[model samples]
Target: MRAVVLETAGPAPHLRDAVLPDPQPAPDEALLRVTACGFSHHDALIMEGTLRRGVTLPRVPGHEVTGVVCGVGDGVPASLIGTEAVVVPGDIGHRRDGGFAEMLTAPVASLVPLPQGMAATGGALLASPIGVALRALEACGVAGGETLVVTGASGGVGAHAAQAAHAMGASVIGITGSPEKAQRLEGKPWLDAVLLDDEPWEEVVAALTGDMGADVALDTTGTSLGRLAAAMRHGGRIALVGQTSPDAAPFAPAEAIFRELTLVGSLGVERRHVERALSLVAGGQVTPLVHEELPLSVESVTRAYRAVKRREVLGRVVLRPVGF
Candidate 1:
């Protein structure tokens, strides 16, 4: 098997490919032939040492995994063999070997069967941008006829959140720091409006909502909470995700108290969320936002990481063990 590992993680990290023997599955696990895996901004953060907890050096860092089961260990079902599925990340990518290799093993219980016709690239993101976005939406109690704001709208979770919110009959305002991203979101049917992050986005959100303010917000950029709260209607809910932004978002405790806003921190996807993501993809409610797919290699992974760090990627950059 060929695998990519983070040989060193620091300000200037080192990553390279290696030739290794295929891993054998545990008694309760299944061995999969890797298909597609997403290169998440989370992966980039680990690579840059911005996030170090639970990560070990010389590790395989891809968690957004999808593959075909080729063999099952003792006590596992043979029916699982040849089943296409997505690995629900627990210890796989963060604490153990992951999908960067052409083959990897995962607990059979952690695999979610992929729906027919969902491409491997899209399946790879079921547990990530799609599922994570849905989880955030659920946290915020998104509903039809409501106004919703999606921060970092061009990125994976934000983009999918905007789409799912729109599909649920909400009016979505997608805000992005890049004008290029604003332009990109404008052409999509998911968003009612697109606002540049440089603009007074709060004012725009207020104006767009006719001063009633957004009924709910999906805060992908964990920075700038005070402004986010200001744009929300009193009693509105805000679902805050990971630290996607470099700068800190100034928070106002008084404002949140006075507004009686509900703030919930959302992270990681459940098995149910992954299933819902599959349903959404099957129904065309949400398009898997794959920026591009690169073949598994050291140079390809490096290029994808650079693109993610620059915020140049719209959605996710996926990698395939085999060329498409």
Candidate 2:
């Protein structure tokens, strides 16, 4: 098995490509011939040495994995062989080796079979940003005909959240720090408006909604809790979905008190959420969220790290193993 290892973590993290023995499945696990893996900010953080908890050096750090089940261990059904699936990275990428190689093993319970004809590249991200997006919307309790604001709307999770909310009949407003990204999210059939983050975007939202503010706020950037609260109408709910930074978010307790605002923190996803994400794709409810795909190599991984750090990536960055 050929793999890329994070040999060291620093301003310039060292990456080494090595050939390792193929992983064997445990009693409750399935051996996966990995096809595609989403390179998430979580993976980038681990490689950049910013996030250290549950991570060690020289690790294989890819969690959003899509692969084919080549074999299954005891307690697993043999009929599952040759099934294309997406693995929910439970403790795999963080606590142990993950899907950064040609082959990996995932617990059978974490595997979600792909719908009939879903491509491996697109299926790779169903568990993370897509499933995570749906979970956030459920946490916020967004309903049809409501005004929903999505911060960092060009991002992986935020982009999907905006589309899914739009599909659910909500009027969507998107916020992006990058002008280029703003253009990409603007004028979309799924998005009603796009706001640049150069100014206090909460004010823009207030103006756009005739001073009533948005009915729901989805905050993908963890640092903008206070701003999101300010952009919401009374009794509006805010779902904090993604954390780009480790710092404590600035929030106004007064808004939650006098304004009767609801704040909810959401992370990870359940099997039902993944199933919903797949359904959305299969039904064409959401337009294709094209990812920036690169082949697996030290150079490509480093390139991806820089793009994510600069917040330039529009959607998820996917990495494909050699031989596709």
Candidate 3:
């Protein structure tokens, strides 16, 4: 089968054609023909050798995968054949070869049936970034009518979280670095306000809530964007989901203690959150903002990774492994 193989980990991965033995599904597994896969910054981190511990070499890195079940192993239900599904990217890309290929073999338990209206591109993203957003909100205990702030709101996870919070009746405030991105959310019903990341965050906060500040803040910037941390109201909850800036300084302990804040760390979307995200997409309660779709050829995969590393694209980048 044709797959993007990572023979060595470095600043970049080698995208090439290599012949491999056909995978034999285990008794509880299903063989899937991959249709689409979502590319994330974490994939780049894995390639660059700077991620969580215990990452092994020569591994397939994609986790956000969507495809159709073609074959099932013993002990797997026969009913899943011909069904569209997405494989959950489990445990931070561990113990599994990912979806960036012509075919994938994953446990049947990890498969989620794709809803009728969910597109392949959207399906692939739902299991990862969207799941993270939903889990973040749940962790922070956000509720309707409460104000929530989303830093890096233009990114994949941020956009989905903003919409989910909005759907839950929270007043959503999105923070972005570009006016063009701020303009993209103009007609979005979920957003109560949008602010530029470069502006004075305090002033923006005062204007949004008459100086009360946000009830919850989800930071995806990975950096200690002081404004986001400062805009939280007393007793506000914060969920840290990403580290765009790995070397960022810690948030002020004194400030957090004085405000009686709840700061929680979130990573990897669990099975339950992935199910909720899929259901939301299936019901059309939320739509993923897919920015680009590239062919699954070797060259295309390399180009897509470069674009992601350079931060040249907005929203999600999907790879079409099978022509539609």
lDDT of each: 0.89, 0.86, 0.80
Candidate 1's C-alpha runs over 4 A off are none
- For model 2, the superposed segments whose C-alpha errors exceed 4 Å read 247-249
User: What lDDT score goes with residue 84 in model 1?
Assistant: 94
Instruction: Name the candidate that leads on lDDT.
Output: 1
Shift of residue 35 alpha carbon in model 3, Å: 1.2
lDDT of 1 at 259: 85
Q: How well does model 1 score by local distance difference test?
A: 0.89
- List, residue by residue over 1-324, the lDDT tens digit for candidate 3: 777776677765555555566667889999988888988877777767667466665666688898899889999988899888888776425446777778889889888888776789988888878998999889899999999999888888888999899888999888887787788767778778888877886578767887877889998886644566678789999988887755975567776777788899887787899899977877778888788988876676677778767666567889887552
Where does candidate 2 clash, by residue pair?
Answer: none
Q: Over the stretch 171-239, how does candidate 1's per-residue lDDT look in tens digits?
A: 999888888877777879989999887789899888888898889998888876888899989999999
Of the pair 1 and 3, which is ahead by TM-score? Answer: 1
* Model 3 CA deviation exceeding 4 Å by range: none
In Å, residue 268's CA in model 3 sits off its true spot by: 1.5
lDDT of 3: 0.80
